[model samples]
Target: MRLRALLTTAALLAASACGATPDAPAKTTLTWWDHYDSGAADQAVTALIARYQGAHPDVEVKRTAIPPAEFRAKLDQAAASGAFPDVVAVDSPDLPRLVAQNAVADLTDRFQGWAVGEALLEPVRESARHGGRFYGVPLRSETLALVYDREVLAGAAPPRTWDDLRATAKALTRDGRAGLCFAGLPEEDLTSTFLAFLWQAGGDLDTVDDEAGVEALAFVDELVNVDRSVPAAALGWDNAQVAREFAAGRCAMMVNGPRVVQVLNQAGMNWSVTALPSGAGGSASPLGGETWVIGKGSRHADAAWELLKSLAENRDNITEFGAGLGALPNRGDTVQDLAWQWDPNVAAFAAQMPEARPRNGYGTKYPQVSEAVWTMVQQVLKGDREPEEAAAEARAKIEPLLRER
Candidate 1:
């Protein structure tokens, strides 16, 4: 028996010496979820993952592209089950609600004094925080602008002021084409587009009952009712529909974002973008975009943070993602890339970034306030309520929501 035991020990030692060893540590697999379903965006994300994996062969990133409409519900379910993804891309405005649910990790200390974080655009940087702490990083951002067909303008300059807008729109309103188009559906579409006008008029969600608010609403009333420059059928149009109408030559000008550039280019139309006509308050645009967050329950938080940090810090990665999606990069440095500077369509949106304001300061009650604003907009656009009455009603509902926040 002693001889057999000696032989066994010798065999084990020999095997170890010959390179036989315990299995290597399992490769770190980080799961990522995002709601970018378009082909260009999907391709960009896939390429980003490929590059990341190439640099870190020991790490694997598993990505799932969720549909936008179903993404929120899926996140809620994952949060409840404690099976959250390692990294998630959420709409910037929804960050407050996720923070309230403790669904995302707090990166305040991790991002403290980080150079990349310090370089984010003001509104983008602000949107990534909740209660004065950072919870995410702004990946890309977009804002509204007035897109007009150059051919339709017929040597006329784009509108620069409210009076110019009315006159230009009226002049362009002949034939079957509407002079101006905007999404006015009784949904977030209307709220997002109308907020630009509201802000331009020196009003906001909290000041809807003020004179500025009435001025904004009444201006739209004039366009739709008095000037007949904007058709009533616009009430049912969404941003995509507005873009489609413009592409089809049914609209001379439209209020839209950079994403419409792809549509216009694909349609082979001659288009140019300009800042929205300035009102009493000057030009103001609403900020919109996605933020990258680490899930609260992620077991691989460190790895996730590394990936997130890389994404924000790497210029190529950031610019590629932004340009691929036709959105503006949130990083001030990246925004100066030749890709954006050379492209007039994107440059127009980038120029507006300085004055862009996020619809996020209202905290978790923002959705409720948006609901009230949209309701008021629908009422005014339908001519069911005068601008003054709609403003009063909206203010009453919005004030309570803001107070609750």
Candidate 2:
């Protein structure tokens, strides 16, 4: 019996030494999840993953594309199950919540020495960092801009300054068409648009009681009150409504992102885009878009990091991804690259990236804070409260949310 056991042990040791333990099950397949289900974006990511797999034949990548609306819920369930993807793509605004939950991995060391690190725009970079540690890598970015009907504007130039925009919007309000449209519903879209105006007015959500905050609220109030260019229904509009209204030519101009331009063009509307109007302080727009992150529970973290680094730093990949998907590139150098700069519409959006501001005090509880502000805005627009009263009420609500964060 001892002789037989010794022989069996020797056989097992030899099998391990010879790398014959079923070849380690051919290396665990890496899973990548993204909230990009649109046609071009899906194709581009498929192609990029194919290229990555081709380069690393030893590693297999499994891709799952989720629609933006269902992404958070799906991710939450996956995380709870310990089956979260090795790599995740999340919007900048949503990243804070993920970070707060300790769901994402710290990527400071992973991104070190990467070309994408140097190429990232400051605003986009700041959005990916939490507590001085980089938590995500910006893959694409965008900012709100004025999308105007070229035929409607006619000889009139797009507004370059805030004062100019107010005047232009007022002028364009004739003929049963609104001068401007915005998403002002109780949602992140409305909060984002409002923040742009606030930032342009030199205000921030964190400092809602300051002069800039008051001015921003007053400015929005003017659009409804003194100017009367924006329709009262705008208070209930979301992103889709704003786009639909603009596409139908019900609004001569609207504050929207790059996707709006794409939608308008697809619908055969004659439109042009310009930078968000500069306010008393300067030009500013709220930064929007997703970042690539590694989940804390990932088993193939090293492989995922490599994939993220490749996707973010490779100029060809960046250009291909952004161009195919109509996403704005996050890299400043990529924005200036001849390939990206050649597209006039893209160039216009890129110009605004420098002034793009991420949400103030971006952390957990952002949604709660956003909801409170939106409610206040809605009340003010509905004539239930004055701007000062609304601002104070919003401040009161947001202060508690911030403390919870």
Which candidate has the highest TM-score of all? 1
Give the best candidate by lDDT.
1
In lDDT terms, how accurate is model 2? 0.81
| TM-score for each predicted model, relative to the true structure | 0.92, 0.87
Candidate 2 Cα RMSD after full superposition onto the native fold (Å): 5.0
Task: Please give, for residues 261-313, the per-residue lDDT of candidate 2 as tens digits.
Answer: 55676789978788888887788888888788899888888888888878765
Q: lDDT of each model, Cα atoms only?
A: 0.86, 0.81
- Write one digit per residue (lDDT tens) for candidate 1, span 1-405: 999999999999999999999888788999999998767788888888898889888789999999987998898788777788899998877788888877889999998879999988888898898889999988778889999999989878999998998899998997789999999888777999889899999988788889999999999989999999999999999898999999999999999988787678889999999998999999988998788899998889999998888876666675456657767855678666665542567777788887788877877777778889889988988889999999999898888888754
Among all windows of 10 consecutive residues in model 1, the one with the lowest summed lDDT is 335-344
After the best TM-score superposition of candidate 2, give how far the Cα of residue 293 lies from its true spot, in angstroms.
0.5
Q: Tell me the deviation in Å of residue 6 in model 1.
A: 10
Model 2 stretches astray by more than 4 angstroms: 1-27, 80-82
Residue 190 CA error for candidate 2 (Å)?
0.5
